[model samples]
Target: MALFHVRMDVHIPHDLDPEVRAQTVAREKAYSQELQRSGKWRELWRIVGQYSNISIFDVESADELHEILQGLPLFPYMDMQVMALTRHPSRID
Candidate 1:
């Protein structure tokens, strides 16, 4: 499996309808949970004072990671960066 570091910043428009925002958040959370259960999403850390997050993912390939990310409910409103990871030569895993 390959490891990836993904950083995401949410950019939902301020004038968006409240009901739609609520539904979007709900779906996003549910989808995130689904990824967690599937073992593809490994860890998530919320950035303080911002609508952003840093996540670690374990997947087979970059294509699979892209597929999983595009499946997110908030993909349209998110600015994301994905970096492929490699084990450090000095580290044991």
Candidate 2:
């Protein structure tokens, strides 16, 4: 499996309908939790004072990661940065 670090910043429009925003956020939560339970999403940490979070994912390939990200309910309202991870030779478990 490949490992990745991802940071997501959300920016839902202020003018968006309240009901729609609530529904979308709810869906996002469910979807993210599902991924976490499945072990594809490894870790999640909130960035203090921001509507953003850093996450780790373990997946088969970059393409799979891309697909999982694009499937997020809040995909259209988020800015994301993704980095691939590799173990260092000098590191010991």
Candidate 3:
């Protein structure tokens, strides 16, 4: 498995319908939880004072991560930054 760090910032248009926003957000939550339960999504943290989150994912490949991100309900409204992670030699666990 490969590890990745992903930062996602969400931007929902002010003109979007409230009902649609609600449903999309709900779906995004459920999907995120599902991924967590499956162990693909390893960690999640919210950015203070922002509609953004930083998460870690363990997946088969970058393509798999790409597919997973694209499957998010709010994909179109998100700006994401992703980086691959590797253990530091000096770190002891």
lDDT tens readout by residue for model 2, 5-92: 9999999999999999999999999999999999999999999999999999999999999999999999999999999999989998
- TM-scores of the candidates are 0.96, 0.98, 0.98
TM-score of structure candidate 3:
0.98
Report lDDT per candidate: 0.96, 0.98, 0.99
* Model 2 misplacement above 4 A: none
For model 1, the run of ten residues with the poorest summed lDDT: 84-93
lDDT of model 2, residue 79: 100
TM-score rank order? 2, 3, 1
| lDDT tens per residue, model 3, 1-93 | 999999999999999999999999999999999999999999999999999999999999999999999999999999999999999999989
Ranking of predictions according to lDDT:
3, 2, 1
